[model samples]
Target: MPASAPLPKSARRPRPATDYDVVIIGAGSAGLSAALVLGRCLRRVLVCDGGAPRNEPSPAVWGFFTRDGVQPSELLRLGLEQLAAYPSVEVCSLRATEITASDQCFTIVADTEASRTRSITARKVLLATGVEDELPPLDGMREFWGHGVLHCPYCHGWEVRDRALAVYGRGKGVTGLALLVSRWSKNVVVCTDGPGGLTNKARQRLQKQGIAVREEPIERLEGTEKQGLQHVLFKNGDKLVREALFVHPHQHQHTNLAEQLGCRLNSKGAVWTDKKQQTSVPGLYAAGDTTAGMQQAILAAAEGSLAAIMINEKITKEECV
Candidate 1:
């Protein structure tokens, strides 16, 4: 019989299952930073992101070294472009569905439109999945978030400097926020939103700083779509006009991915990680708002770099073993 051409395999080794030395979840500041480090080390790294960043609402992300006033989307785009230069790094524009540990490695399941579901095996996992902001139930509050009704003074304070500002504080942190906002605005009001836990000392401190302390419960927010916040409506049918409103949203972790992987969490429900960004679960690390309450992009990036170094070291040790 004539020799026939060799037959190609029906399924090619499935692209080696896209295995990696490190798998990072969430491609925000933290995950991208980690990818940059691991990729430089020539380690196979995959970053899975859902493309929904926590700071998407904010127009600009400040406090970064040189990219100050850069929009959040633009910053992420630049970061992704930088990471693309590394041949060892791959960015998957998808959401991580499930993660499980088995036989000294982590199995990550990601969902992609064309691929349906793809699995990756990794020696280490970094969780930079950030958090979600739970704004109070006030009318017009959500509509104007990031525009005029805002959070994080350092992030948005400079834009609204010297404007009439009001802070809605129903908790202990209100006093501190009021003081912080006062630095940017000469006219600041601390609205206690119905007096839940304001101490006499706290009230006096606010007054001493020329901050008006309002004990009325806010009913709703009044504003125009074009101009953002205009006034704070009270339960007693009173309205206090203001140019901007500062609020402290109840922040919550975006996913239970960390806790599900047996990582320890603090009393405040934040992921617990050491200075090296290693979590309670060995071979697993967490950074950014999910791990720390600081909630700043710069802090998240720093933590991610730390985690990357620690993870790389652990991987090296394992390879030697």
Candidate 2:
């Protein structure tokens, strides 16, 4: 038995059996949506959620229709509740550790909360496992992440629109993102954290817009999680006052399951998928943030729906043959 107590009987959902038609490796918007479609199609589907959502820190998930401004945890709860109506679907709060394929079947080994491991076999697999953002290692950065510090402007831009915004990061991507952040806030500064590696053309363009460029390395972020970001301190003993900071973090898949299964990765490190959301490996599929760079709940759900549809079609055609 695990050291922690199990969920109350009322809170526990039935677990899926050993063999399944499909095993979805994430329970976020994309995985849950895919599971719903596959379940309604009468396919035996299991959704394994590791219980860690990238958007958990965000106050609300934006840009999603009907559920706009909804809390990420609440949105996931509602999705899980809706999925309960489908008898063919089951959810396991476990993390997939390994995946192996052989002779038209795939075996998934996952670490369970019950202090034991479980293995299940499925005919097909969906890699909805999203990416983890690699934010810069700066004091107080993690404390204010997703609140005062954010990535997607469309998702969190409206709330901080017109606020004193600063772009904080390095590399060429930061230059473009800083320019983009200018749209949400007229008063913007680009804190390159030293040199910024920006081309002369980019610097001239930013200068034309009257955006202050601070090329000093950030020493620390001064603020409490409650008070939000106050200043970006520099090694030169100067500080830039800002309300929010935008970053374009380099992200990687949350797990190595895709790589273990031999799925090809694109240049940006996201899982490469075709128009149908099928990965390079046959019988394997991917969706959501893992498949593209533009990370949004609605877009991920749409990709999940598309992946489910294609998977259903693929399975049906296979059966017919």
- Top model by lDDT, which number? 2
33: Cα error in model 1, Å: 0.8
* Tens digits of lDDT, candidate 2, 94-143: 89999998767789999999968999999889999999999888887888
How much does candidate 1 score in TM-score? 0.91
The estimated TM-scores of all candidates read: 0.91, 0.92
- lDDT of model 2 at residue 204? 88
| lDDT per residue (tens digit) for residues 192-268 in model 1 | 77874878888788888899988888888898987888998999999998989999887877887886787788888
Off by over 4 Å in 1: 1-18
The candidate that wins on TM-score is 2
